[model samples]
Target: MLSRTADHLYWMSRYTERAENTARMLNVSYETSMLPQSASAATKAWQSVLSISELLPAYYQRHDEVTLEGVLHFMVRDETNSSSIYSCLQAARENARAVRGALTTEAWETQNLTWLDMNRLFKAKKFETDPAKFFEWVKYRSHLSRGVALGTMLQDDAFRFLRLGTFIERADNTARLLDVRFHAIKNDYHGTVPGKGQAQFDFYHWSAILRSVSAFEVYRKVYRNVITPERVAEMLILRRDMPRSLHASMYEVVQILEAVANDHSAETQRQAGLLLAELQYGRIDELLATGLHAYLVHFLERVHALGGRIGSDFLATADM
Candidate 1:
């Protein structure tokens, strides 16, 4: 496959996943921010979403008060925000157009229609009626696009690249959520500083975390109980059985990266191999023992660095 095609496929998948995770993140914040205990916490919760998308500073530079109105506007409607609903759909469409021959007619139509709907929804200002509904619609469309891609595309290098992008984005997003929750309200030996075991505490935040990943219902089904901090953390960050977990997503990313790089350059293979070893040998018990926040920040930073390595390894090319 052409490197350009591979790049498009990878980013197409990443942007779609980014859009979905962003929606879930905001949706959970909406639900959490309304709770009496969580009132006034929207800025912190939503700031992390912007941060994860690398848009925090940009948004702050342009405006003040990361309020629900400001952040939501940026996240949902800001064309400049690549992680916004509109930008992601536009990027997905551009990628679909780039690799038109590699995609099925159904796949192309689905992507195009998805983009059209997102554009129309943003234009209609229907998100004001009920932003939650609009975000849910975006998430559903993302799922539909994924389904069509999986159901229609061949299980070839292109597909592998798409899966690679998705799982990595998920892993990165999960790590960010964990970092925010563990750091934003953690109790500790430090003096009673701000955000130290606030009114909502980890318990309330756990629900937010669970909801952010769309794992609340599935988590309850699996564990069959109310949300717990440790269980939610373990399920999201460490559980191998759960597809959305950091561990599971990391596992998929490394595997798909390996598969995509296997027949290519030795450097790519070696990078993937190094990443795989980190995942395989790095024990979750060690992370849990170290305290979740400390471990998660380190893990997220490592993932970010790995993404840099990936870009340098196979995706980096100069414009002609």
Candidate 2:
């Protein structure tokens, strides 16, 4: 494949995955804010959404404060925010267009139709009136796009690159979600134990966090108990069986990297392997003992660096 073609295919999938995950994150904040809480707590929930996206400073540059309406507009439609769902879908469409010959017809149409529908929603101001429905639409479209690609595309390097982009983006998003959600739960827990005053209050928040990643039911099945912070963290961070968990994402990433290995990708493969191994053997108790935030920050840095390495090796483009 041409370097430029590979880059477009890779980013096309990344942006689509990003659009879906952004919807997931925003849905969490939107739902959690409706729960009974102080005005400040509601504001903080919105702030956490921006923080997880690492767009907090960019957000403040365009707005005075983090209001629900402001965040919805900024994250859902702002063209200037390149990571917004609008921008992500737009970019995904453009990239898919650039490499249409490399994509199956269903894949291309899925990307194109998603962009068209999103524009209609923007014109109708659906996000303003019904953000949750709009978010579900985005997630549904993303699922369709992925399913189309997996079902129709040949299992070639193009497919491998596509999977690579999805898992890398997913791994990064899951880590960020875990870190931000963990801190929010910690603040609400206030060193309180389960079955106490704050327990019920914390339950809703914890449930929101799991639902953000679509892991709530998986948590129920795996633990078959009340949602505790420790177990939630364990399931999301370590459980390879949970589809959205860090370990599961990394598992896919490592396998994809090995499948698509090249002469230049050895270092990238080594780094990816090391990260996957850490998640593979890592324990929740040890992660908490050292500080989850610190560990996650380090993981983010390494993942970002790994992304750069993958770019240099395969895409021949800078990490976007």
TM-score of 1: 0.87
CA shift of 81, model 1, Å: 1.8
lDDT by residue for model 1 (162-184), tens: 88788878888888877776666
Query: Candidate 2, 16: how far from true, in Å?
Result: 0.6
Q: Give every collision pair in model 1.
A: none
lDDT (CA) per prediction: 0.75, 0.90
lDDT for residue 238 in candidate 1, whole number 0-100: 64
Off by over 4 Å in 2: 188-196
CA lDDT of 215 in candidate 2? Answer: 89
TM for every model, in the order presented, reads 0.87, 0.97
Best by lDDT: 2
